[model samples]
Target: MATATIPGPRMPRAMQTLGWTSRPLPFVERAHAAFGDVFRIKIGRDTFVVLADPADVKQVFTGDPAVYHAGEANIILLPFLGHKSVLLLDDAAHLSQRKLLLPPFHGGKMRRHVGLMREIAEREIAGWPTGVPFAVQPRMQALTLEVIMRIVFGVDEGDPRLARLRTRLTHFLETTATPREMRRLLVNGPIRAERRRIFASLLDPVDAVIAEVIADHRRRDDLADRDDVLSMLLLARHDDGSPMDDAELRDELVTLLVAGHETTATALAWAVERLTRHRAALERLTEEARAGGEEYVDAVIRETLRLRPVLPFVGRRLTQPQTIGGIAMPAGTKVAPSIHLVHRRGDLYPEPMAFRPERWLGVRTNPYTFLPFGGGVRRCLGASFAETELRAVLGVLVSQVRLAPSQPANEHVGRRVITLVPDRGGEVVATRVAPDVAMPSAA
Candidate 1:
């Protein structure tokens, strides 16, 4: 039998929404502290059952994506990601789309893009102003955005349309970075008209740019030999030999542009923030970088994801009867596998708050215990790509220039709609100081 209710804070709806919007991480931690590993939190009209235990997290991740329905769990994002997107699809359709998409992101295709990524990262890092504090997020965003535009959309660097699309998409993101904009779209009422008006205005030109790119790809004969992701997607065949329709193509492209770039930019910024404060780790990382420490670089990225996951949690809406951590839950119940809380648990990670890259050097972490990319069928398709991008970007960043924390105290993660962005935009000072020590093992 299903439990009637779970233990959660019984705060008024208004307060819950306010607390969640203002400070999501602290709110979740408080809930875990007060109610233990399993608890519930109601925000607006929805109730989510949150699981902090790694064992419980495994159940949610290992459960079939069809039953868990990751796309449905993120219905609130349809206004941005769209309906035909692989991100919003479930079960068979999701599998079909993944089959077409996976090939381009793996194998020789990924290897071919590795050098392009390094070039892009180096060029962007070269432009940063030295001896002054600047937010790394903007540069990281620009670097990732340009990389995706070229690699994913097949747009050439000199194209005027690429510049326009970048501006328009950035503007769109700015508007959507608040609670007011979210409520304008998610909630229905008299305000729905306003949301539509604004979204249409923001979306029209961006869609036009994407449409133009798609048309160009369709007309090009040379694309058969090209290996850009969009070209690959254009040529990718379904089981019955049909190509994806324009809407499907456009939606998936937009999803990649947004979903692919945003999380990575935020994560890179967080990495810089963490490194600045953890001087020892930063020094070791610099030594590794100067000495070409690929393993150490990987460790730094791994530790960054562990310490500050750009997305705080992976949520699923229960489709049928399910139990997690011994508590039975009925259908329609929403479950949030708490990534942030899980990473910070004392039992799982000693000195949970410390930033230590050395810890990951020789440890084989249990998949469920360290779920930065989530797990199971719905795991992030861009996981390997994002990690590759981070390593490439950081390789250019640390090897070429040295950075230090501009702020004495740690910067808090602020609410940015769905993403928890670094507060004060991850401010850091750029210095061209050379690393004095070389890691022989890395060399």
Candidate 2:
């Protein structure tokens, strides 16, 4: 069979690289407009065949795990997340790590962290300056970072260790997410020696703190009684009955930090950004938040994620030749389901760019059509947990105060490494604060 030639922009690779790194949404929109549902585009050394059709997305998501190498497609993350990180693992290694990490984020186990999430949200919400504009993304980052530290690292409030690690990690993420650094990342890829050394300088101290926390947890007698993820992981045994070693534990912990922290924060920031611009939706969500029901709040989150998915695409590099949507792809081709484009397709969503939570009410969205988190076996293990945290945080936020856009126009999307975020950091003003909201005790 002849492989169909996938059409794309005939522009130089340098222009494609710039567009991808700095302004992905426009880049993708232009490509999809010019080349239809499937097209090829190069970023750094890899050529991604971007697919916006749900059927093609379903194929990549449900494709044979051996032939669809998600980890290889995500190799750029390895320098920060480490080789043993599940995000960087494939096949049996990926399955094993995923199994060990699953129990901690299981439904009942995850709900245990909600009260803490709300408390953190309340603490942060209380500090926002009233009647003044501020970037909510940084505040959201602080809130989510604290949640990850407390929940995943088992370091609770007032822990000096938490304070130190938080400072270091925030700076590290900020530095890496800057445009200059991101451009460098796009140019050099993940394994260049100087880049690795620079990353080592940032990651080493964070790793040191993680190592300390791991050792301290091992020596504690209350390990079995604790509900935090690190404690649960410590108690977990592999299928072979061996406990995970220090390196493995460290890698997984960092993976959770990288995977959970900014991604959830960016989602929350976008939620605030979207709600502030749409008055009726904001009013309805505020009422829902105060009255205490999951239905509408859940829809609001779904809609926010749909319109502003953190990562624009989820990729799987072909390890063996395969056909998708009638096009024969050779091995080494990265098949990326364009999450941003799929979510915006008018066929799948009417008035696709509008923020409408009502669209999700009483609606069962097809998983492939509405995957803010990537689909199938490689789907984010923390999906439920992230959603749970979003609900808790947003609930506390709306109940405590009302937000309005700082500027008349909406903020443009910005690239923070691999995640899409509000360019102006979701600038919003606290227009009103509900008086004397009752504080729930910590769980």
Candidate 3:
């Protein structure tokens, strides 16, 4: 006989609607506090189990891919990323697609491109004016976009259309992901109409650029020169020896562009904020970077991901009946493992909220506990690439520039789209740190 399902409190319908279409972190935090590790919340007639327990997160993430596929979790991204993108694949298809794209993000390949990342960062940082109050989010976004365009698409940094595409896409993402904006879109039909108009305005340039790349690849007689991710995908063959169609190629390109750039930008921006707030940590990072190479800087980056993960929660649907945390879960149920809550568990992390890079220096936490990039078969494809870019950009920034928060410490920053972003854009007063002088230790 099956175990009886554990009944949990449900979020009120109005609150559920508000939470679903608006920022839901406060409500989620309250539920976790009330119900312990696991709780249920109703969103638009569907019951989603929000789980923060590390054990339960491990079970759902590492047990069986079929039982908890990400396809159902990523429905919101489908209209933007499309079906063929690796973000939406599952089972065998997921595995195959991941294999095809794995080379560019592999350790060796990423190491080879570290110079490119550093070069881009140096170029961008050189342009910042002294003692200027600049929005770190937009500048970081632009820098990451340039890195992605060069490495992933092999597009020149001087391309005009690329700049326009980035602006349009950024605007679209900011508007669509805002809690208040999403609520309007969900409740008012006309909001979607306006969104469609904006989306159409943006897609034209993106399509033209991608189409040109596809045509160029098709016309090339010798494929040896094609070495970027785009080129690799162009040359890759399926089991039946069939090449990817233009439509498939377009989806993959867009996926890499959007997913590749946005999350890293968010992570970098948060790292800047954290480093600014903690003076000792920032100074230590700079000293370590100067003395050695990227090890300490890497730890700082990893710890940042642990604390304020770019994507706070990832969803998976239960395709088979399973029991987690002694509660029975049926098929078609959505289970969310929150990185925000999991990384802050006192048992797992002694000072869960403290910004300490030393924790990552010698100790290695379980993969499931430190899952900013997730784990198992469905782990993020660009994980290695992201780390490389982050290390390079952060190392450069911390060593060359000092960042001070423009806003007060008590200000409430919130989530936007697939990332944790500040509500007013993370404003920072940046000044170029002299190369010879040491930065004061973070207090």
TM-score of 2: 0.95
For TM-score, the strongest prediction is: 2
Tell me the TM-score of model 1.
Answer: 0.93
Over 1-443, each residue of candidate 2 has an lDDT whose tens digit, in order, gives 22236888888889999998788899999999999998999886668899999999999888889999998777777778887899988999999999999999887777788888888888888888889899999999999998999998999777789888888888878787777866666677777834456577777888898899999899999988898999999999999999999999999998999899999999999999999999998888777776677798899999999999999999898899998988888887888999999999999899999999999999997889999999888999999999999999888888778788999798999887778999999998885564665323333
Q: Give the residue spans of candidate 3 off by over 4 A.
A: 1-9, 17-23, 44-46, 157-199, 220-227, 408-411, 435-443
Instruction: Tell me the TM-score of each prediction against the true structure.
Output: 0.93, 0.95, 0.88
- Runs off by more than 4 Å, candidate 1: 1-4, 178-180, 189-198, 433-443
> What's the ranking of the predictions by lDDT, best on top?
2, 1, 3
Listed per model in order, the count of residue pairs whose N, CA or C atoms clash below 3 Å is 0, 0, 5
Whichever of 1 and 3 has more lDDT, that candidate is: 1
The TM-score obtained by model 3 is 0.88
Worst 10 residues of 3 by lDDT: 1-10
Worst lDDT 10-window in candidate 1: 434-443
Q: Model 1 misses residue 418 by how many Å?
A: 1.2
How does candidate 3 score on lDDT?
A: 0.75
CA RMSD (A), model 1: 3.1
lDDT score at residue 372, model 3, on the 0-100 scale: 92
lDDT of 3 at 191: 34
State residue 229's C-alpha deviation in candidate 3, in Å.
0.9
